[model samples]
Target chain A: MMRLRLVTALLASAAAFVAVSAHADNLVTKDRVGPADAPKSFTLRLTNDGPTSTDPVWAEGYQKLFSEFIQRHPGWRIDLERMSDNIGQEQARMLEQAKSGNGPDCAAVDSFVLALFKGANVLKPLDEYFTKEEVADLFPFIREGITGPDGKIYAWWWNTDLRVLYRNKEIVPDAPKDWAELKAAALASKEKGGEGVLFNGGRWEGTTFDWLANFWAQGGKLVDDKGKPIFAEGENREKFLKAVNYFKDLVDSGAAPKRVATIVNYDEFNAAAAAGTAALFIGGNWQYGQLKNTLEPEEFAKWTFSEIPGPTADQRSTGTGGWTFGAFSNDPAKVAMCAAVVKEIYAGPGNALQQQLPTAAALYGKYDVFKTEANETFAKALVNGQARPGVPIYPEISNQIQIMMGDVLSGTKTPEAALDAANTAVQAAFARL
Target chain B: MPTTTAAAMGAAQRRVAGPSLARRIEANPFTWLVPVAVMLGVFYLYPILDVFRLGLTNASLVGSDERYTIVTLQAMFENPALLDILKTTAVFTIASVVGQQAFGLAIALLVMRGERRKLKGMVALRTLVLVAWVIPGIANGLIWQMLFSEAPFGAINSVLRMMHVSPVAWLSDPNIAMLSAVISNVWRGTAFSMIVFYAALKAIDPTLYEAASVDGAGHLQKLRFITLPQLRAAILVNSILVTIQTLNTFDAIISLTGGGPGRATEVLSLFTFNTVFRNYDLAGGSVLSVLMLVISLVLALFYASFMPRREVSE
Candidate 1:
């Protein structure tokens, strides 16, 4: 009893000390972003993806961006939160909170899944901040991608990401011109004691993107000009079936490891690439910094990025995916401030400062990511990067596709059977909605 | 008239002396129950009721058309994957629980024997066995996942390659993935059964084993006659608890497999999680959750039936 009393008293005193210190600290700092004389004050919540201070160079770039924002808004205080996980899950969580009127003032949302939140009325329209012409100035496909069915822009697209083929130059010096050549190259590489390729064939959005490039390359469409499911019709079905079949063959034939179906994304691939284990890797461009840190200089230099190789030489296709700022607050004043901060962070000045691609057309050339030789290819390849199907139910469709691809790659199901299953599942999802 | 006079006198005395907390609680016995009742109503009752309510509706997270509907149930009934999913769950639970318990019993017996014989390294063996249990579930999953991962860096594959043996697809194959998950789970969970069985072993009367030995009973005969009967209650309790635990196990599968290689390792818990969190189908998730709760309840009832008629006077 005496020991308990002493511990309890200590805890109470510690709590009191912490409370007093916090209060004193808050009073002294006041989280200043502007001059004391500035009368107006707004807490603009800014969410962005960038490196931390430990990543000195990238972190310095982010600091420069934030400093620029502070200079632009003399009276506003910005609280920036860097989302540290898969931003898709973050977007879902943010939307879930918004439904209950419990959300941050602003957040970065994955552009592909933005429609899900927008359809649920979790995102506020940004018409008050961005003009119609300004929205139009965004790459037409991207603008259409972020626009809701109500024809309102709910998010400001930041720079987008493209899935591309990364290869070891020494192992397979020339980039394969087409799928047949790529397979041949991979097989030859395999003969020399190397894993031929690494790709995310797991059940995830990553798998969906992996399949999407192939589907689009083959001139297949999930939905037609009328926005109806058209794969059940004439040529699309055959093309889609072929794409899925080829995907299976890529794994089963040992061009890609059979274990590819279990790799979620980029986990083991990073280490494997740094160690020079795999000859080919298909992945997002975000890992450039990680590779630089982990890989030996020679190994890093041996790597190059190109458009995802296709079934035919002329078919250059890939999927563009990335994050954007969306306002989550319903308070008109807070929403207004969110829009201003978000716009500044992703467009004009902020775009020019950060390493990621800027969504704005005029600011595309000003990106730091474009300075690298590989990024130059990435930038040019962006033109071929198609946004995923812009629909509220796209996540469901993406899940079905992942399942279909996974079934073909990992299970006993034939490609045709898996495609039929996916079609039925997607149709069921739409019907339920 | 006397009652009125007595009541008046009591009221006058109460005005002079305020009721203490204990006195007030004694006067109104229900007051003592209020906090517990409120907690149950709020935390326990409300959520269960809400789940039932949600299960009756097509309650999706993304839409506002949440109405009284059985679409979720209809879909569940029509799903061709239901049987396969159920089979996966059953296989995972039975395989994990049975394997875990049997292994646990062996370890317990070994440890007890070690204690009697003063065996060297026995303590270290126990610590090694418990390492998986001591680590957090997610961390345990990661350790096993790396061990099972294919190719050059994976622990198992690395060893196999060293021996000039072909590396097996541990997690990628639909046939192998569930077994891999179960293996990881057994590694993490056996410690619980070990501790339980150890205590029961300790509680067994030493005289019984000594007398059996004196009567020239062999080791196996002693185990069958003396140890098995004495361990019946512990075995029943441990078996049921571990089975229920296995049925509810999701973390290892989630971290190691995420219920894939095309949903091959997808247990009921994982399926429910994918529906609720990934698909955002709240009603469907609720139905799955309710089904799980019903199974747990049945197990609980079964355990209750086997409970001792009187207090287990251990």
Candidate 2:
């Protein structure tokens, strides 16, 4: 009789615990900036660089805003964790956690990596939480990039970056207007005891981005509009070969560093430019701000941005890439809260303007507070920028490009053979896709 | 007469037979091992079974398929890059283990021979080496990365320039990245071998060496015939441990190089990681991991089988 009573008591407590948990899951904080009161108070597990005051000044502003948000939502809590800077390692950790039936409610993912997460089904679709009107407010390119081929927006984005040629105005009074002129200028710079141009050729996504866009601007397409690999064909293959040859010449002539094979990313290139070792570099808008903040004002002013020279005299092109916010939970109310937060962070009235302008000013000392002036010009150039291929197989294709470029830079493989091999690998990737 | 004879026979048998099986076990005192046997069954056996089950399933980061097939194995083979990574893994594991053993044994011998006053310095050095081993692998990787940074202002380049040597791209060049990773691993691993060897050396009999010296056996002959033979068991154990540790190393390579400059230093583990997380090919990655597991098991078996069987005793 005593054992039966103990068992009954245990059952009662288990039932009570379940009831309390359900109740807690349904409780919502009403102080948010959205119309409807969400019926849940979610603990969103987000990955950010730790809560520190050492971030760039603009990042500090965002942090302050985030803190204010926490204060406003008394019933809600965001449990943020600092993730490793290595994207590959972080993804592996997240994937391992997810396999154990526990995953973060949200994550900050790079735009290029969205497909990786989506293919693994680690991302939760944001469509149910957001309306069509809300989706329309985001930039079309960003929206398109975040949405899967199945038409679900798996992630959200705020920050945008694009690659442009940064030139030393003191060294070159007039920047090169086209590919031919750029080559000549680089050679001349080398003869004058300066590096012609600097960019990464290390095997990574960055190298692929720089190489593919340059190849594209020269009328070389790796894949056709129908998503069929075209680089193995007659004219396209020849164009790719020619472009690689030109890149090789630049390296061989000491116009670009032979150590390009060692440059893993834009960070190294940025450091070089800051030290006055490189005369020209290809980098993003964020780099301009980085240089302004890290280098002295006098040295920083010597730098100015220009379009990446293209094949034709008048044509120029650059590569656009960015980071995005992603939801990883399927709870409706939590998803709604996250969607609202993203809207506030990215598309709300003054967020983008505030992020771009003051950050540009305080960090880089380059201010165009009015969007109509220099900011508008910068935005126009970015709008014309080409994004890396939106295909799910892009990583593999990117690897092929990096390998080919590394071979070219290292003088291991001829430009024609490297392009041919890259073309073959890309074709194989597309076939699998 | 018959009853008296039977009684006498029974008494004689009882005297000769020591005890029954249960009584013998109780008297012998080894019956206490039952709890240890139960603990091993509960802890070790259960986990091994669970892992084996997981390995056989189609479970992945994505949902699992109901059917089981050799599809995963096939995918592992289809990836042409796996061979290069496996080759790198072999080179790193072998070089690191061999280097650690040689250096560790030498240091252990020196520490054994040094005077008591100088032993403190050796102990302190050993402690410092242990500190490197105790540091998390991720931290070690980052510290090495700072040392190998290709830029002029990087630590290694700065030192090289000061020495009037051209700066080397330690992590960037394919030829150097693997070597850099091996060096970092060796630095962290040699301490473990040293500790093991030092313990083995401490347990050696001083009387045997004294007797050998009295018989006019020289120092080189003593090391070759006596010291080395005495430490054989410890050497075997340390080599096996270091081999396993070095073979499974992924964090150092990932943190230091990210297996880049065209996948120059990508070991097998990193390749499996890229397959599952980066490429989202779960089955393929699992097959690769299973293959790596098989390789490790085979290596363990080989080590066990080939280890010196003759036990040395004074």
List DockQ for all candidates.
0.40, 0.24
Error of 2 at A105 (Å): 3.6
User: For candidate 1, what is the DockQ?
Assistant: 0.40
List, residue by residue over A1-433, the lDDT tens digit for candidate 1. Answer: 9999999999999999998655433322323334445555444333434423345564556555555655676565555455535455565666677788887777767777776777888888888798877787777667987787788788888667788888888899989878888888888889987889888877678888866898898888887654556664579888888888787878878898887887876756787886668888888876765677788887788887777888898997898887677787767776787677667655655445545665666665655545677667667888888888766557767777777766788856888887787788767766776
CAPRI class assigned to model 2: acceptable
lDDT of 1: 0.77
TM-score of 1: 0.87
Q: Ten consecutive residues with minimal summed lDDT in candidate 1 chain A?
A: A24-33
- Restricted to chain B, the TM-score per model reads 0.85, 0.81
Q: For residues A190-294, could you state the per-residue lDDT of candidate 2 as single tens digits?
A: 676676788777756677787666677766666666657677588887777776777778778767866676666677767887767777877766677678777
